[model samples]
Target: MKEVTPTDSEEHVRRRVSEKCSVDESPRFSRQQSFGRDIGHAAAETYLVTRLSFNLLGYLGLGYQWITRLLALACYAMLLMPGFLQVAYLYFFSPQVKRSIVYGDQPRNRLDLYLPPTSDGLKPVVIFVTGGAWIIGYKAWGSLLGLQLAERDIIVACLDYRNFPQGTISDMVGDVSHGISFVCKNISAFGGDPNRIYLMGQSAGAHISSCALIEQAIKESRGESISWSVSQIKAYFGLSGGYNLFKLVEHFHNRGLYRSIFLSIMEGKGSLEKFSPGVRLKDPRVKKAASLLHHIVLFHGSADYSIPPEASKTFADALRAVEVKTDIIIYEGKSHTDLFLQDPLRGGKDELFDHIVSMIHAEDSDALTKDAVAPERKRLVPEFLLKLAGKVSPF
Candidate 1:
């Protein structure tokens, strides 16, 4: 967090001026300064939500704080409940609960699949990795996305990975690699096109996905083999991924040391170089090939306060510098979770679904061969739902 000073005052002044003009470093400021810079950011978010036309009546109808508080408390209880017990709540109780989403299974892991009836064959598969930073989250959060992806005729898979608070990011990605391996081995059997599989992750999940891809890229370059069946993925979609955990550790608090602790917990030691994708990019050759833009898509809300949209910008800039094909869609005023869940701030779900569909369409043809005409699609959601209705997690 501390910036180095030049012994010569003039040189120090020059460096500051240069930084101010540089797109890369200009907006990165002290946390205190950053916290205060969001007056307009807040307003912009509010305007966006209103413009998007959320159910205003729904917001108004829930009139009391006590009502909202009670609902939130109930959700908290559900989250804190033990897993086997939670399954019971999902199964025998919770009258309002819907049926569990259907998924595919490997011997050791399971995946919840969301398939759109409207489109298939050439459609892309968006593989989701939910974030809980690294310590939390499970397959349950992925259920909404299953339904979301079903709307667009694209197939979706919410993968299960190992967790931390116990394991490290590596364990998570290892599990992810295996889950993907399972998908590659058996996806076509279930009507998914393996060649078109794309990775979409949030928070810690994003970091894990990026690392796994880097590992896969490295393995491919060295002609090394891993347990996973597939080595290459078509693209990545990162939502509020923590690319620079070091920054959060160094400047914001003393928590940077936790990374070493995390490393110790996972791998029995710490190596920033081993854990960080940003650090891994120091080698120009590796960076050139591993850049996700060539095979990925990024969605980030500019107003995200938790992880800092700068992380996305940093990753995008790094990818773009290498001339990798990347598209960054920044919702002018939105936050982290808001990118995925309903955000009163910005109207983007339909657009998000639309973009996902179009991306699938674009990647479908070029996926295995050269790109082709969009397949004639009709009633994609209904048929896909029918096929998935009686299914369960396969793993």
Candidate 2:
């Protein structure tokens, strides 16, 4: 120590810091490289095939029939096939699943309940809502998620609600509310803990779920229909959801068919404030239900062009602004349909699946009870202005 020189000490400190940095970063770098390689390879193959098909179709004078047939096949493959396979698996493999439980009077108001293989006592429940642009969703679409969660000892309920042309957004919301009401009262019979219910919805399902939560909060505030408090639903998992209607109004402005469909879902009214959960929660009228906002965990794909990731970001910001505890997880390079397609059981498991499982098991004591410290306030402005507007209209 008496012979130590400043130059030697500085070199020693630098060497130690370099060693620490190498230890911390090597694994992360390796993982990132592997992920990038996989995504790049897939993207390249898809691009090449698509380009080749386009060139061949152009050369062959592709007709409308071919396009129509191709579109139909794609819809079947993307929207129907996965759900069918999932339902088939559950039916053939999982013996504990109960199918077609009527939750309401309407024909579409039916749900499928999946119970774990072994249950010793009351289990936490996950009520999953499927997304199909508020136009063509089925409860069976949630079969994959329902079965997956049930395998983890969580009770799962996949609900169906009337889509556009058959029912308006308000009606669909009512149907989900009814489904939830039924689950609340009857799930105990299936060995579920009514107190630990979790609401999970994707895309349009997420929008409807948000509406239901706010509606419940309103009812609880007024002391009307207080049978099930909003807080009773331990958490909300909003995957690729549109929480703000104003952003969507701009987003779908150019897309004609979807614009009309979205308008119909809003009952042909431009009530952005009324239908938007983000805007609605900020209103002074909704202060009573502010406590429930902390229960939200928004998940979105970074490459989700169907519904821009910004939707979740802005929604989370709004909730956090009001002091509600909220969390957002971004899945890098994943698209809208890619999220569910990466099934955990099928060896296509991704970080999103792990996140979902973790949240489902998260204890109530671990939940945040107070508003997080607000970051420095910026000039008040519209949320969409902060980022270019964005998804699937359904959750």
Q: Best by TM-score, which number?
A: 2
Residues 35-126, candidate 1: write the lDDT tens digits.
34334433653574454224322322444533453455355434323432433333222222222222223221445555555433645677
lDDT of 2 by residue, 1-395 (tens): 01211223334423432332244457879557545644664476457446545554543354554355456546435444444554565553454766556666774777777888776878889888898767557786787677666766789988889776567888888889888877777677678898889898999999898888888887777778654667668888999999988788657544323455467668765666777889988888788777655478999889887679999999999888777789999888766665764333233334776677667665633221211221222222232321211121121
The whole-model C-alpha lDDT of candidate 2 against the native structure comes to 0.68
Whole-model Cα lDDT of every candidate shown, in order? 0.53, 0.68
For residue 239, give model 1's deviation from the true position in Å: 1.4
* TM-scores, each model vs. reference: 0.61, 0.71
Candidate 1 lDDT for residue 303: 68
RMSD of each: 22.0, 20.3
